[model samples]
Target: MMLIPTEKRLDADTPPEKRGQMRDGVRLLTYWSDSGRIVHGGFFQLAHQLEAGDVLVFNNSRTIPAELKTVDGIRVRLSREVEDGTWDGLILGESSKKLEFMHGLKALVTGPGTEPPLVRLVFSCSSSRLLRELYRQGDVIRYEHVARSWPLQDYQTVYASIPGSVEMPSAGRAFTWRMLAHLQKHGIRLAFVTLHAGLSYYGDDKWPNPALHPEAFSIEDEQAAIINDAKANGGRVIAVGTTVVRALETASDGNTIIPQAGVTSLYLSRTSKLTAVDGLLTGFHEQEASHIDLLQTFAGEEGVKAIYKEAVAKRYLWHEFGDMNLLMRQERS
Candidate 1:
C-alpha cells in the first residue's frame, strides 16, 4: 500500500473517471487495533467514520492559469503564478538568470510561451477572465513542457469553488459529489472558504522570505459564521485540505475563531498551535515540502511518521492527482 511508487497507482484497478475517487479508490487511515496502531482502509468507509453533525470546511479556492516561459530557450519552470500577469519564474538555467529576470521585464510571450525556457508573461490586463472561460468551455489550461503544451484538468480539485489558486489544493480532490451528498444527508453540513494557494515552488529548499510570496488570500463573513456555529454546537469542524487549515488557523484568535477577511502570511510550523480544525483531510505531500512539518503539529512526530510510512507503503500517487490521508480526532482511550 506504499504511496511513493515511481509509477502511478491511482489507476491500478480503476477506470478513467473512477481513478482517485473516494468510493472507488482512496487510501484511508484508521486505528486498526486497541494498541493505537493506525492502518489503511478503503475510502468508502470514511463517511461511516464520521458522525452526523460534523461540519466539513472545504477550501473551494479555484486554480488559475500558471506557467513558465523564457527567452533563451532554457528551462525556467513557473511555480508561483504571482498576480494577474506575473509569475515567480524558476530559472533552471541558473540562479543568475533568476536574479537577471528583472532585466527582461519587457520580453513578452508572443504565441503562448512554451515550457523548458519558462517564458513568463506580464499581462497588461486581467486575464483571469480567460481562465474562467477555459473552465466554462471545459478546456484545460495549456502549459508548455518542452516543445508541446500540456493541458490540465488535474489542477481542478473536486471541491473547487472560488477561483484563485495557482495550483489545486488537492487534499480534498477524492471527495465525490455522492460522498458529499451522503455527508449532507446524514446531517453533516458543509461550507466553503477561500484561501487561494500561492506558488509552492520555493518549498523548504530556499531560505525563508515571506515577502517573496506575492500572493495571500481572504475569507468571507458567512463562511466564518458557519464554521464558528459548527464549533459552538459541539459539531466536529473538519478541514478538507492543508490550505483550509492555514486559512482557518490564520483567522483564529487562539480563543475564538473570527470572521476574518485579510491576507495571511502566517506560516504554521511544527510548533504552531492549531485551534479551529477537529479533523484534517489532506494528501501525501512530498518530504521536501514544509507541509510535512506543518502536519507534525496535527499529529505528533510518531503519528506523522506512521501515516507517512503507510502512504509510502500503500502506493498512493503523489501530487495533485493522488490519494489522500484523513487524520481523525485522537482522544485518550
Candidate 2:
C-alpha cells in the first residue's frame, strides 16, 4: 500500500467559507503525465490552463445528510439503498440486532453486508417516512479531519441537482457558477453525469473495498454524445472526480461511451486500463485510501508518488475541503 508519511500528512480542518475565502480561492496543482511537468496556482486560474474543446465531465450527485445517531448515541452512516428497499450503512460503534432512533423509529439489523462494519438496515417506518426523518434528523457525514459540523449546503457542489450521494462529489466543490460560465465562454465543453458516491471509509481505520461497494450512476444520451464528439474531434475527456472516472469507464465500450444508468463497483488501480477518461481533477486523498489507487491508474504509481511528494512539500491540505490536483496526459496530436 502507498502510504503518506505521518510527518508529511496535512489535513484541512476547516472549509474555505470559515476561512473567509470564496469557494474558488483554494490552491490548485496541475501535473502533466507525459512531460512530468507541474504547475502551481489558485483554482481561479483553472480556465487559463485548458484549451478549447477539452471536455470537463462533472458528477452532479448532491450530498445528502447521511449521518444519524441511535438513541444510545451510536452513529450510523447510510451508504446506499438497495433494490429490496433496505439501506446499507456503516455502524461507527458496536451494534445490536436493532437500532432505535427518535420518534420511536427503529431499524432491524437484517444481516452482514458485503463488507465489514456495514450492515443492512430495515427500518420500522416506511421508505418515505424514513427518508423524511433522515433529512430532518441526519447530519452531513464528516470524518475526524473536519473540525466541526457544517450545513448540507456546504458539502454540495454549485451544479448539484440530483440528491443521492452520501458524501459530496467534493472535487467539484471548488467550482463556482461564474467559473463554469467562464469555462463555457472560453470554449471549453462541459458535460455532467450522476454518481451517488458511497462511503469511502468504515470506522476504526477500516475501509470498504471499492470493488464491493457499488455506487449508482447515470450517463444520459446527450452527455455520452458530447464526450464522444469531443474525443472524435481530438479533445480530451477530463473527469472532474474519481466518481466521474468510474461512471464513464463503467459505461465505456472500448473508446466509446454508452449512455446508461446502473450500479458500478469498479475499482481502478495502476494495473487498470482507462478507456474513456484522459484526465482527472480530484482532491488529495489519505495515505492508504482507495482514491490513491485510482490516481495511480491515471499517472502510474511512480507519477502519483511524485505528485504526492510535491504536494506535501508545498503544504497542500488534504480531504474533501482541501486543495485540488489536475492530472492530464499530453493531448494526442
Candidate 3:
C-alpha cells in the first residue's frame, strides 16, 4: 500500500532520537485476524492477550557492532558473513576510495551482493580476528532517524545471548526482564530460535532481492520440540518478529519443524501460507518496507492498511525503538 504524503513518518521524518523510557512505555496494537478487531494498549498488557499455553518464539541473535569508520574516512557496515575470511559489506561516504586496515588486515571489494548497495569484501584474517577487531572499533549501525549514537545495549533484547546479527531483532527489544518475568509467571512459554539478521536498510528503494538474499538461521531440536508440542496441544506458536517467522517456516517439514541450521532464502508474501507461525509480534514497519508484505500475510491487505493507518494516526513511534503490533490468527483455539 502506498503511503499518504500527509501522513507522519518514523524517526526519519519526525524529530530524531528515542522518546520516553526504554521498553516500559511501548504501545501494543493487537489485531485479531478472524474478525478484523483491533485493540490498543501498552505492552505491559501483553500477557493478558495471550493464553497460558501459547508459545512466543524469539530470535535470540544479538546485534553486532557492525558500523565502522575507516582511517581513510570511508564508512563500512558488514552485512553478512560470506566465509571465514570474507564478508558482504556495504560502503558509504566513498566508493572509489581504497580501504585501509590495521594488523596486516586487508579488504578488497569483490562485487555487489544481493542488493545493489551491498558489496562483497574479501578479508585477509580469520573470522575470529575479524570479529575481535570489529567489536573493538565498530559501533551499532544507525539511520537518519537517530540523531546520535546509542550503545549496543539499546539495540539488544533482555534475553539476547548469541552475538551474530548485524541488526537488532527489534520486535523483542520491547521485552525487559520485568515483562519476561510477568509472562513466565503467567505460564506463557518462551522459546528461542536464531536468525542472524543481515543489514536490512541499504538506503535503497526495496529490500534485498528475496531470491538472492540468504540469511543464516539455526533452530535447535529442543526449540522445535517445544513448538511442535505447543501446536499438538492446541497452543498457538507466536513468532516475535519476521526473522523468527522466516527461521521457523524455513525449518518446517510439513506441519512439524525439524531442528536444523542453514542459510534460508525463504521470503513470506501475501500469498505464502505460513505453516509454523500463527501470530506475530513486530515493530511498525515503514510503508515502503518489504516487511509490510509479510505483515500483509497475517493481516489481509485491507487489514494491514487499516492497522498501519491507525498506527500513524495514533502517532506511534517507528523503527527499531518503536511501538509493536501483535497480529493474532483467528484459527487459534
Candidate 4:
C-alpha cells in the first residue's frame, strides 16, 4: 500500500467559497501515462492541457443532505435507496431494531446490510416524504477531517442538476462556469452522465468495496453518441471522476459505449483494462482506498506511486475539498 506521510495528510477543511477563492483555483497534478511525465498547475489551466477534439465526461450526480440524527443522537448516513424504497445506511453509533428521528419520523432496522455498520432501514414515511424530511432535518455528511459544517450547497457542483448522490461526486467540484465556457469555446466537448454515488465510508475505519457498493448510473443516448463520435474521430474521452469512468466502462461494449441506465458495481484496478475512457480527472484519494487501485488502471502501479509521491512533496491537500489529479494516455500516433 502507498503510504501518505502525516505532513501530507492536511485537510482542506474550508470550501473554496469560504476561502474567498474561485472554485477553479485549486491545484492540479497532471500525469501522462505514456511518457511518465507529471505537470503541476492550477485547475483553471485544464483547457490548455487537452486538444480541441478531447471530450470531458462529467458526472451530474448532485449531493443530498444524507446525514440524519436520531432523537437519541445517533447519526444515520443514508447510502442508497433500494428498489423496495428502503434505504441502506450506516449507523454511526450503536443501533437497535428501530430508530426514531425528529418530526415524528421513525425507521425499522429491517436487517443487516451488505456490510458491517450498514443496516437496511424502512422509514415510517414514503420515499418522497423521507426526502422532504431529510431536507428539513438532515445535514450534509461530513467526515472527521472537515472542520465544521457547511451548507449542502457547498457540496454540489455548478453543473449538478440531478439530485441523488448521498455524497458529492466531488472530482468535478473545482469546475467553474467560466472554465466550462472556455473549454467549449476552445472546442473541447463536454458530456454528462448521472451516477448517484453511494457512501464511501462505513464507519470505524471500514470502507465500502467499490465492487460491492453498487451505484446507479444513467447514460443518455446523446451522451453516448458524443463519446463514441469523439473516439471514432480520434478524440480522447476524459472522465471527470471515477464515477464517470465506472459508468462509461459499464456501458461500454468492446470500446464502443451504448447508452443505458443501470446499477454498476464495477471495480477497476491495475489488472483491469479500460474499454471506453482514455483519461481521468479526479481528487486525491486515501492510500488504502479502492480509488487508488482505479488510478493504477490508468497509470500502472509504479506510475501512480510516482505521481502520489510528487503530489505529497508538493503539499497538495487531500479529500473532496482537495487538489485534483489528471491522468491521460498519450495521443494516438
Most accurate candidate by lDDT: 4
Which ranges of candidate 1 are over 4 A from the true structure?
1-24, 31-39, 68-87, 92-122, 127-151, 202-215, 331-333
lDDT, candidates in the order shown: 0.59, 0.88, 0.83, 0.89
Off-target runs (Cα >4 Å) in candidate 3 are 10-22, 96-98, 102-104, 204-206, 331-333
lDDT of 4 by residue, 267-313 (tens): 88889988999999998876766878888899988888898889888
Give the Å error, residue 91, model 3.
Answer: 0.9
Better of 1 and 4 by lDDT: 4
TM-score of decoy 2:
0.96
Give Cα distance to truth, residue 306, candidate 1, Å.
1.4
Report the lDDT of model 4 for residue 166: 96
Instruction: Arrange candidates by lDDT, descending.
Output: 4, 2, 3, 1
Best by TM-score: 4
**lDDT tens per residue, model 2, 1-333:** 565786677888788878888999999999888878889999989887788998999999888898889999998899987854478988887878889998887889989776777888888877667778878898999988887888888999999998889999999999999999999999899999999988888867788789889999999999999999999998889999999999999999987999999999998888889999999999888766577788888787778988998999999988888999999877343
Please give, for residues 206-293, the per-residue lDDT of candidate 1 as tens digits. 4223333434556678877887888888787778887788778888877556776666666776787788887788766555436766
Candidate 4: lDDT of 61?
89
Q: What does the lDDT read for residue 132 in candidate 2?
A: 80
In candidate 3, what are the lDDT values of residues 1-333, reduced to their tens digit? 775443476543222135436565678999988888899999889998998888999999988898777677678989889788778888887656347765555687877766677888887788788888878888888877778878788888889988889999888988888888899899888899999999887785555766577899999989999999988898889999989999999998768999999999897889989888899999876665467788888998888888888888888778877788999878344
Better-scoring candidate (TM-score), 1 or 3: 3
